[model samples]
Target: MAAAAHDPAGAYDLLVIGGGINGTGIARDAAGRGLRVLLCERGDLAEFTSSSSTKLIHGGLRYLEYYEFRLVREALAERERLLRLAPHIIWPLRFVLPHDEGLRPAWMLRVGLFLYDHLARLRTLPGSRMVRLRTSPVGAPLQARLTRGFLYSDCWVEDSRLVVLNAMDAQARGAEIRTRTGVEAARRQGEGWIATLRDGASGRSETVRATAVVNAAGPWVSETLGGTLGIDSRAAVRLIKGSHIVVPRLYEGEQAYILQQPDTRIIFAIPYERDFTLIGTTDVPYEAEPGPVAISPEETRYLCDCINRSFARRIGPEDVVWSYSGVRPLYDDAAANASAVTRDYVLDVAEADGTRPALSVFGGKITTYRRLAEHAIEKLKPYFPGLAPAWTGDAPLPGGAMPGADFDAFLAALRREAPFLPDETARRLARAYGTNAREILRGARSLADLGEAFDGGLTGAEVDYLVRHEWARTPDDILWRRSKLGLRTGPDSAARLAAHLTRGRAEAA
Candidate 1:
């Protein structure tokens, strides 16, 4: 287990303002570069926008139409790197895009796929090819009209877990990670920043000093700059709300469908949680506070309709098992359409004459977070002249150092080591914790030894491990972010887990 000491006594080299994907990624990268880093998040790691992604790491095929060649090439290259870096959470996935002659012609899509395949030259993923929907399993659930389609490759990621693992690696590298600690304000103190951090639970505040500050607040980017730091930022971020609805399994195959809508936009219907189909992502303009965002009725209906258009098995709003919405903080490119907005990120560094530097991140995608972090640190190299060179591209994340980087082989080894765990339970634990699963199953020899069971497969041992190592306090943190067992666990599961954690804390005290 990784233990972190909370002592913000001396001046630090860097203070990261957000705890989302970009913030955590930068924190991890900066710490690996030998910087004295302190990171503070108002909520749990990946509590908001970072946790609400479509959960795929791929080069944006659609962005090619907008002439975003640079973004597409970099994202495609990063996709391969991330696949190697975290094989446990990120794995290859085949995407089937059914032919839509009216929307985009067959030859046009072929050309796009050709560009996509060749853009990232050094790749092991199979190139795209034409497929007959009638004969292939991918076309089994699709409408009969969709006869010919194309198949390409991308990768699926455990999005929230990726964020937590980055934060974990950052903490393990000597970076201070404080969850539920919000930075209320910041001001120039001498040649550094004096930031006021407040603990939400205890209503306690502390003042810490850092030579530089990083503003990576996703949706709250502008707010953090103007409201918290009283800094004028030239760049602006557009908040576009993208919502997804999860319904009962629509098809039997493991492949995902990328359906093109009539509006020139696309929606994805991917396999989710083994029991459901994850369909999503409508780009609707949003203007509201970023916190507590939910899926609107119209957006939910839009998603259902989009899936209905592609799948032979029709579904209505009533078929939805779960729904979630998140606002994408895309850099405002003055585009009239929300879907056309650039997914690329912009780093704005402010360094007035003789003043401390503050870098604000504008927009980025989950697929390019590592690259984004590397870029952020590279931009600040002048301030920290002795900072180490970049090393995250080749380093394996926590628990990702499996033998041969093969998850299946590692999982088999895990089952062999712990023969008492059920097949399904062992698989789930291995996928979630990777090699660290042994740490949770250390002394347990039988099912009963795992401790109290919460309605579903959740056990007391797993909960304690989450609290002690992953900083998971509430039931939501365990059920939603750390794992998605909330869908299977009973209604009383949260209360039970809450009681257990409360009692455990009291006992520890």
Candidate 2:
């Protein structure tokens, strides 16, 4: 897929310049509305900020402290909507917030939880309630000093899968999704916008015309506008780095712990990947060029200290098996610190005398991506008069549709149909693909029918499906993003698999 300079026949109604959650979400919405859409990403979808979330679909309980009632309310409302839309990847989770003496007062927290519970209608999740940590099994892992805790309801998400499902749905609805392609520049051309898109592999540039452009480039939102589009907007983005670490499972059970730090910040210790504890999220200001960032020594220490203090079993940097960091391009509202920056999104539509529209999105969390998409489409509605009404709220994302959106029942049915499949394999496939898993294993009689078996239950059929449909090219795309099978892969197996996939792709070409 080499880029061509002149392709008059390839004109589009909208050119979305990012494949992260917001960009993919917008493309999905626009395409569902019958817009001719093209989305280009310099890397794989959700390769950066979109994938590097706390992986929660929740009303930010901490935002209440900042008086972001509108954001919290909107997110709370969207929580159930997303759960309905993508039940396969989004599930309700209970967070235990222990009331420590030196941190936020117990009554203040009670009031905040009260407000959080009443902010919106929660149909699938439970309301917050105080728990006697002294007697409850949920508190057995925590330090004895944390005798009092409050259990609140939120949702956990497969963050990267959310992005992929959106892009996949967009493509199914007739949107052109180009991964490993970058938009080099865009300019207002007469009544619309013309952009130069470059193929990341071949380094060839192509010219494309679109009715409008959406700059949802995540950490590169500002750079895409000023550096690439040569348009200065009234809005700007502040870079903030958020980091997380995955360690050997520290505690038992499915519940997660939200520990308040000494600096008035909070960190989450969640059960991850069946056998790991995921801890994270430091709000350190970043002042460098944006790319894949790593957890710093100081951040590692900070997170470890937070965990060590809260849990009975102490952990140090030595316990960390994997750590990742991503830079958040927050809307610069002049907050005093990185942690205080608003997670609400701002859509700035820069136009040439109100003719050619270029909308740049800044500062949004994953929890509110669908709403942000509706607003983004609304911002560009002036150019496309025949644009359809918003319908994503009621739409099911790819592989999310099942009777009543009940995952447990669906899993049981899958097990019945594929009785030869191991319990873990069946559960993983059902969780990952929902009804679509059937397409991969359709008529398969046994594990051998799935072709070569890889580490962590990954199969040749699954890899081929990802490469063919999900735009997965490299091993990281399959192992890390499309699935977390990498955690179980040995270096030799991974290198061998990478070479095999590369050769397979080349041979297919």
Candidate 3:
């Protein structure tokens, strides 16, 4: 079993550095194409910027003001595609863009919505339409003066879960996913490149060789290029910090709000975890190190102020329960304003006539990761001649293949099958594991059969499944990425699971 879990040959066709969305997406695509791929991440998947997003799968409506029609169109199309591909984690959302008479004019807002509606022909979701706040339920929580607004369709995603699902699919297709393994350095060796990987936990090093390499290290892209590969890359990335705050339930609706700030930037207040309203996203110029970013007091105030301007209820920094920050490694386009910088991605390939190719990816949002992977693999087609055609667009991600891709129907069936479990517990499992929920519940007829129970719905059986199937070594991997129960559980919840996991690992070893 151990031998089958790793690459015995110690070599691969592609060595992908970084386990974020793009790297995992590329590894999944390449492995599906019959390429032997190895992906190594210095930390847990989506532990950084990939998990710290606005959690929307929409075409940037604000980007239209900057005339980024191409990006908008592509993203809008991808949004619809993802809704079908991963119905378990991606769902349609209605965003209310309140007409702030002080800022963008009513006529201008109408025109932008018109363009946004017509950009890509939406099939699963409804188009945009103007609404009167006086009668609309969406405006019940807003100020009286905000009497007019426009409602449009977008999608919400389980951001970190999306990354893990891609990695799981990649591993299922014969790709090696090594978490907590950092690639210290790599150099050209004849027709391929050799890399040195250091295990974070064991403090051990091993050498790996691959025919090609992909650097999708997010914020560490430039640093990885210069420090590890010894190549001075021309590709520049602008580090812009984005932060979000989670507060108590702001309103009583499932719909989200897109607040237009006085600075012309936008903030989203979405229904999160059924108990909290997630508000956020301040775009600030960042110049510090990338990892371990946290929302500053100023950023919290800024976000609170943005919300206060739109909603009737007032909130201060004290209202914030939890906050997170991430530095977006955007491709430098020389834009004066940090918010004006392009979110588009750039793929740079370094290779001579006979040298091995090292592909570096920079600056992309979550919505277009799959398309970016397709493009990246196509660029390296000359080296991988036997690669398969793109197959991820129509294919369902792991555990997403519900009947007709209908999540509600699948949830109903899951509840009926697991009558012993609570409705909320069944729903959580269905949402997180989808069709794979049965695998975790196998041979368990009752709650006691599932073994020990944590404070929340988490159980010993689920933890064992995560460690055995997913590359979950630490409790954070299960709490934060695989699930967001970290937000609701106690601060010591992860620590409390430590002894259980340690015992389990020792018994298995």
Candidate 4:
């Protein structure tokens, strides 16, 4: 459950700021290892960076250029572990990277693929292969000149849900996940740190204490360190704004494309939501204040043109139906190019005394979050002599505890059990909730039992479930983050949902 800004037992062992993938992952891992943990987020979980990813859980194919072998190897090893942990929200996706004539040579591409394939023991995802783009259906959408391509395996994740699932698991393990709350200031008092948490909803500040503080604040790492914690991290962040655009499904089929740009950068054109194609992620140096960002006209045009070079069907900024942007807080290694900044994480520790420790997380991608969490906890081992050994690798996150981690088999059985549900609705619920989907549909014999219908299969029952279990408050939390129904559902349905939630709250009051 999402806890209120009230902690009756007083002090905690760990106080985690930022509710992104890294923060929640650390919270889940630390709490499971028997720590009194309290995770406070300034907004809803993944309201920024974590939610705004290309949503690929892969050893970044392009990172090979930068010689990020260790990062790639660690990420490559984690794919199957995460796939097993949350099969509902994560699944294998095949990417077709076509040879663009003047770009990297075929042999170089093969070498990179070979390294990616053997980087780690890939137990679940298949290895890479060369494909004939001219004859295959995957080629139909591409330009004819792109005759040869490399087909490789990666996993796609519901990024926001992954954050939420981690927060949920953390909560289940006795970690207090307090959302819409920010640690205004923290100071080391005696042997521990005393923190003032400001709740956004109530405009109230409460005093809390923790033996250690973990700053996983993604974009606000520096700001949080200097402004809130009054500690100089000495580590800097390179803010690279990444933007994506969604349009009508560009091509038919489940396969996605990784288009190469003349600038040596790459963009992905993936199938998104059922009816739309997701394209994007431009790496631009961000100079402005770091908060919510939008896709600039240049970025939109850049994305369209990148994919246009390969795809036969052309697209433009006007074709964009939805666009989102997030700024990556990469640890600055001072690379000349914005895209060349490392995706690896750097941990800066500040502990004047042995008891009160402040650890700030710098840069990391989603695929390595679990490993990052394990390592973060291990870093604090000196502070907590009794900290339990790491265990997230083999464990399952909440609803993903289905036998064998076989999503297809579990989905088929769900269809048989809930015969009355629409095929699309059933599949959506199964993907979102996994085995726990049945509980939401339990006691309801027919579609009518789902309560008032909203767009994109959202029902009153699901809304109540989200409010009760998922820490959802505003419409945007449910519409955009908890579910992407906002893509298809119009304003009318959103208004109705707003009213329903308001009325429900009033009755409870």
lDDT of 2 by residue, 359-407 (tens): 9999999999999999999988878898899999998988889899999
Model 4 residue 438 distance off true place after TM-score fit, in angstroms: 1.7
| Candidate 1 regions with alpha-carbon error over 4 angstroms | 1-8
Which residue pairs in candidate 4 collide?
none
Residue 19 CA error for candidate 1 (Å)?
A: 0.9
TM-score of each: 0.98, 0.98, 0.98, 0.98
Candidate 1, residue 242: the lDDT equals 89
Q: What digit string (tens of lDDT, one per residue) describes model 4 on residues 254-335?
A: 9888888899998999999889999978999988888998888998999989878899999888899999999999999999
Candidate 2 global TM-score: 0.98
- CA lDDT scores, all candidates in order: 0.91, 0.91, 0.90, 0.91
Which sections of candidate 3 miss by over 4 Å? 1-9, 491-493
Q: Where does candidate 4 stray beyond 4 Å?
A: 1-9
Instruction: Encode model 3's per-residue lDDT on 81-128: one tens digit a residue.
Output: 999989989999999999998899999989998898898876568988
Evaluate model 4: give its TM-score. Answer: 0.98
